[model samples]
Target: MSIEDRKQKIIAEFSMFDDWMDKYNLLIEMGKSLPVIDPHHKTKSNLISGCQSRVWLQARYENNRVYFTANSDAVITKGIVSLLIRVFNGLPPKEIIEADTAFLDKIGLKEHLSPTRSNGLTSMIKQMKLYALAFKTKHDSDKKED
Candidate 1:
């Protein structure tokens, strides 16, 4: 599905919750559904700075798409990353880099988060885009060489 489709689905899901408590519960459940990240990739290099919790994110480019695996020590953070991964995973590097993040505000996720968590979320998005940029650059270079 497209990123817009995924965002709309998440918005619909969040719309079901009348209260922040219920939304938070849903977030916890989403966190539970995140696939476990490989321990080997949980290195200092993969760690995202500025997060109150330890969040490790690893990205790989395969078949012209970028795939991400991430883990966070905090449950809410884990859920937030999982949501991002859901939108971004398996997408072309250019697509990921160009995707708009307004859906986050539309889902009321940014406003609901604490200041630190919000910063962490921003950092996570930045890091993911940076990885996409790197992959896009490499991919473009490879094409030129071909």
Candidate 2:
């Protein structure tokens, strides 16, 4: 599905809950479903620096798309990254980099988060976009050489 479709689905899911606690429970449930990150990628290189909790993310470029796998020591952070991966995974690098991410605001997630967690969330998005940029650059260069 397209990122917008995925985002809308999430928005609909969140709308079903009338309280933030319910959202937290939903996030925890989502966290439980996050795939375990490869032990090899759980290194300093993949650690997102700004998060209060440790988050490790790795991206690979294949067939002109960027695939991501990640882990976070904090459950809520894990869910946050999982959501991002859902939107970004299997998408072309340029599309990943260009995604607007307004769904985050539409769902009221950003304002509802604690300031530190919100910062961490922003950092996570930045890191993902950086990875997409790197992949896009490499792919563009390869095309130039072709």
Candidate 3:
């Protein structure tokens, strides 16, 4: 589905919950559904700094799109990361850069997050976008060289 559609779905899901606790529980469940990343790959290179929990993110380019996998020691944090991955993963670099993350506010995510957690989320998003930019640059350079 398109990112816009996914955003709507997420907002709808969030709307179904009566309180923040329920929403948080749902997010935690979402985190549990994230794919397991192997222990060896959880190195400093993949580490997502600024989070209270240890979060690791990895990205790759395939068929001109970027794909990502992430993990976190905190279940809620992992769920937040999972949401981000769903929105940003497997998209072209330019698309990732241009994405309107304003939908996060509509879903009451940023407002509900703790200051530290918000910072961590921002850091993770920035890092993920940076990875996409790097891949785009490398891919373009290789094409030019060819």
Best candidate according to TM-score: 1
Task: Mark the 10 consecutive residues where model 3 has the least summed lDDT.
Answer: 110-119
Ranking 2 against 3 by TM-score, winner: 2
Candidates by lDDT, descending order: 1, 2, 3
Per-residue lDDT tens digits for candidate 2, residues 4-118, read: 8988999998889989899878887887877668999999999998888899999888898888989998998898888888778899988888998878876658762445643
Over the full model, what C-alpha lDDT does candidate 2 score relative to the true structure?
A: 0.85
Q: Taking the tens digit of each residue's C-alpha lDDT, what string does model 1 give over 74-110? A: 9988988998898999999988999988787766686
Where is model 2 poorest over a 10-residue stretch in terms of lDDT? Answer: 110-119
Q: Estimated TM-score per prediction?
A: 0.93, 0.93, 0.91
Candidate 2 clashes between residue pairs 3 or more apart in a chain or in different chains: none
- 1 or 3, greater by lDDT: 1
lDDT of 2 at 77: 86
Model 2 error, position 88 (Å): 1.1
RMSD of 2: 1.8
Q: Please name the candidate that would achieve the greatest lDDT relative to the true structure.
A: 1
